[model samples]
Structure formats: structure tokens, C-alpha cells
Target: MPSLREDGAHLGSAQEPAARRGQLRLAALQEKVMLRFLIKKGTRMGLLILFAFMGFLHASIPDSGADDMEDISRFMENAGRIGRNIEIPENLHKAQGQKEAGKLLEYYQSEAFKRKYEAEIERLKGTVFKDTIDSYYGDSNGAEKDSVKGGTLPGNERIYLFISSSVPIGTLRNYARDLDRLGDPNVFMVLQGFVGGMKRVKPTMDFVRKIITEDADCDIQKNKCSAYKVKVKIDPLLFRKYGITRVPAAVYVPDVRIMDVTLSEGMEGNAKTGDHYVLHGDASLAYMLETLRRPSGRRSIDLLIEALKGGIYHEVNKR
Candidate 1:
């Protein structure tokens, strides 16, 4: 397995250049949008509009420096089918959902995703500062004492909420909380990349942190927010696996509870896995759940809904 390890300090240092490049890219995009608008209006000043755009584009998108995370692309595999259906390899499936989510989260958080940051995170766990930060930001959606109230993932259905930066912050926040409430590592909120680009991982990290912390407006570094309970992941592979072409969509994978694609050990030889049912829209989780349940008579769907209702959502779990 590729090591999901990296130096946390290097992650901090690369922010300057990446932000500069991001600003340039944003400016260029704005100029292009303005150019298209002005030309469509038929002001008979196409030449002048083009001239203005050229200046803005030159200033905005700039010829460019480079990104700190650019190195990751060299190591990163593009998202696409592996050209073969690989089945679950073994009991190694124990490393299933949570491992994938946590590893991807660390991949985005660490330097170049080559160095592991768990040691640092674990080291911080016992600090007074970390304690204060966790309490203020929220350590869980409704969990107490680092204890999640649930049994095994509880069903054969795997849920995924595919989203992007374009989705409204409030919508993302609600989804994060709901998934956290479900308390299954198998359930996830997957973003394709940061708003501007994936050349840097900080933006994705910061945005997801905000989404899970329930502090959309809080400037993460300057302000205190709720503890982040969920670990939003970026997995283009899963995105491709689900055939996601837009934001605010969801996928329901039924059956094969023990055989998620994220499992790495034994999927190399298998040919069949769960079927994928996708729902496209910007709706509440409950709405999506109901819509997905409709038209499908699979028992797994109901079992999935029951699992959602269990865990922290139980009568006492809710209280």
C-alpha cells in the first residue's frame, strides 16, 4: 500500500505559493466570464472586450509559479476503472471503510501525502490545547467520550454522498452531521477537490473541516468551532466507481456488505461486487433516502434505512 504519511509542517509551508496560484487562476476565470458576457451583449466592442480580457487574464491566470502539492499528481493514480473486476481478497477486509476514509483524509492533510501525520495527531490528542480545541469545535456529532453508540455497520448497504465545492455550505453541513449521526465509517461525504483546484490540498482540508465542525463561517485558524466528527474524504476512484458527473448526488450500493471496493487485500481476483444506484439532486438526506428507496424493492435498502435509524439515532441514542 502507498503510505498515507507526510510531515505536517511541510503542509503549512506550501500554503503561500499555492494561494498565490489560486488567486491568479480565479482572476483568469473571472476575466473569461466577463468576456463571454460582454460579447453576448453585442455592444459592437468585441475588440475592446477582448483587449480588456487579455489584460485581466494576463494579470489573473498569470504565466505562473507552481503548487506544493503538484508532486502528488506524479504519485497519484487518476480515477478510472482498473480494467478488471477484482473481488474481496480476504479477512483483510477488516481495514474497510474507516481505513479508506482516514487514509484519504491524511493523504490530503499531510505533506505531499508521502509522510504520515498520525503520530502528530496522536501526539496532539493528549495536549490541553487539543482538548480545548476538540471541545470547542465538537468531537462528535452527538457522540460522547469518543464512544460511538452502535454495533457493526449493521447492513449490506453502503452509502455515499458525492459533493463538490459548488454545493452550498449549509447543505454540506447538514449532510456531514447526518452521516456522522449514522455513525458508520462506510457512510461518507466525498468531494472531488477544492473549489479552485486540487493542486493544493489545504483548501479541501479546510473546507471539509468546516463542514464537519458546524462552523462554516468560522475562520478555522483564527476562531474556535465545534469539534469535527466526520472525516470527509477525496477519492476520485470512488467517484469514478459511482460514475459521479455532478455535485450533490448520492450512491447506494446494496449487498456484499463485506466487500467494499475500498478493501485492498483481495479484490484483485474477484469479478462481481455490489450494484450501484445513483440519485442526482440537491436534497436533504432523508429526501434522498426516500427517493432511493422508492423504485427499488431490495431488502438491503430497508435494512440500510433501519441501520440509519439505529446507532445514535436510537431512542436513547437520540436522547
Candidate 2:
């Protein structure tokens, strides 16, 4: 009857530990195992801390010879793989050009490289010789005849070479050649034959005048290469006055003397052997521009020579 019915059971009654010795022993064993696990974990943490400290100390100090050797070995091994056993290839250098190579070493040593490059360029320029109406006199052979016609000349100066007619294509071509050799951007070959003389002449003359006034900043972008053209009548006065006793006669003029001197002075200067600022019909356009830019009485003959040589034209009447 007691088993079949739901009788009052001792649910609150406690089972004493001393009575269950096996269970208590098992519990004690589990606690000991947990303690051992925690101790092992602490020991592992201590070893990790010790390793980290040693690594930091090693890195802070200078590397030992052994360390350097290891690094060198690694670099050499990699370099060998890349085919860089000795010095780098000639092309594959910090400075590809001689100029750059010079900079890589002593800065002063680069001067030789500069000189060599310039010398080579000069040699090439010599190869590119020009034959103009004027350059015929540059020679020693028939130079006297050409010189006789070419007046006193300077190394580099803008000269206005007045031609009566722009008709003869050959003569115009020769004149162009002269301009090429002169390396002057400033040149005025006055062509007298064009119709609407003032209409054409005014624009060209005005354009050239602007160049003489403005210097390098002349309206080049505007198709106004007017630094190089002038106008005049097709007469013997233009010839005899400029010593165009022969075709292609050139006259030289100083930047300052264009207004005062007669055109004959220009002609004489072309042939004579002496130092002069203006070449045959050459003028100091750069000098005038500089003078205007910075007022100075000091003559910039050489500088002007450079500008003329650099190719700036100066016209005759536009003086």
C-alpha cells in the first residue's frame, strides 16, 4: 500500500558526508585536478612573458656580427638569383646619363661630363653646316669676294638686309640661308613687289616694330614672326647705299647706331676684320629690350650677340 500510494517522503532529509566516503573522495579528487590545471596554465603564461622580454632585449641592442652575416648571406643569395653579382649594368644605374652619374659622385667631377656632352653637340652642329648667301664668305678660299660684298660683321647680331624685290625665288632662298647661319630670329628682308604696299608693309612693319619693342615676349603665338621683315623701293639706291653692289649684300648696324649711321657703315662692317657689336646688318635687339627692361648704360654687346645668335631678327627701317 505504501509503494502504490503517494506517501510522505523525506525530501528535506540530508545525506551526511561521513556516511558517503566514496562520493566525498571523488569530490576531493576533482578539486585537486582543477587546481593542477590552473597551476599548469599559470606556468605556461610565465614562460610566454619570459620569451617576450628576451625578444625585446635582443632587438633593442645592436645586431651582432653573426646577425650581419646572416643578413649579408640573404642579400647575396637574392642578388645572385637576380643576376646582380658584380656592379649594376651600365644602363641600370642611379644616374642613367653622364650628367646624372656625375651628380651621384662628387658634384664638381660632373663638370667633365657637361663639357663632353657639349663638345659632342658642337661636333654634330658642325656636321649640320649651312650654305647661305652670306656663309660663302666664311671660308678662306673665295671669302675675300664674299667678304668684299658682306660688310663689317660681329659674331652674332641682328642685321637688316634690304632686298629690292622678293621676286627671285633663288635670291630669297639664299637670303633665308643667310638668316639660318646668322642664327638670328631678328631679320627683315624687305620685299618691294607686293601689291597694297602700305597695307602689307604696315602690318609687317608694325609687327616687327612690336618685336623690337617687346623683346622675347613678341607676339609669336599670334603668327606675328614680324621680327624678321622690312620694306623699301626697288631702286639702285637701296643697292649702292647698302653696298649691294652685288646680289646678297649684307650690312651690319649697332643696336645704338641704326638711326645715325648710313647703311654703308653696315656694308663695310660686314667685310672688315675687327670686333664689332653688330654683324653685317646686325642690331642689338636683346640689348635694347634689356635696356628698356632695366635702364643701364653698360653695353650688353656679348649678351646681345647671344640673342642675335639665338635667332632674333632686327629690321632695317624699323631700326
Instruction: Report the CA-based lDDT of candidate 1 relative to the real structure.
Output: 0.59
Per-residue lDDT of candidate 1, residues 1-319 (tens digit): 1222132112223445888757755766677788788777766677678899999878887443457456555445442334344566767756787797788666665665423333333433454225644432234333221222242333344567889888998898888777666556556677665556645545555566657666556654565455545546556656766678998998876654333332321123321445667999989887787778876666655655676567435646557
> lDDT tens string, model 2, 1-319?
1122122222222454554646655666677788899999999999999999999998999857898899999999998888855565557554567766455444322566345534533442243211221231133233223322332243233344554332354444444433443443334454323234422333433332332222345444353332322222222333444445333333434442232221322343432323222123222334333333333232433444454444534443346
Q: Highest lDDT among the candidates is held by which one?
A: 1
Residue 222's lDDT within candidate 2 is 50
**TM-scores for all predictions:** 0.48, 0.21
**Against the true structure, candidate 2 has what lDDT?**
0.41
Give candidate 2 misplaced runs (Cα > 4 Å).
1-158, 164-187, 191-236, 255-301, 308-319
In candidate 2, position 95 carries an lDDT of 55
In candidate 2 the C-alpha lDDT for residue 70 amounts to 94
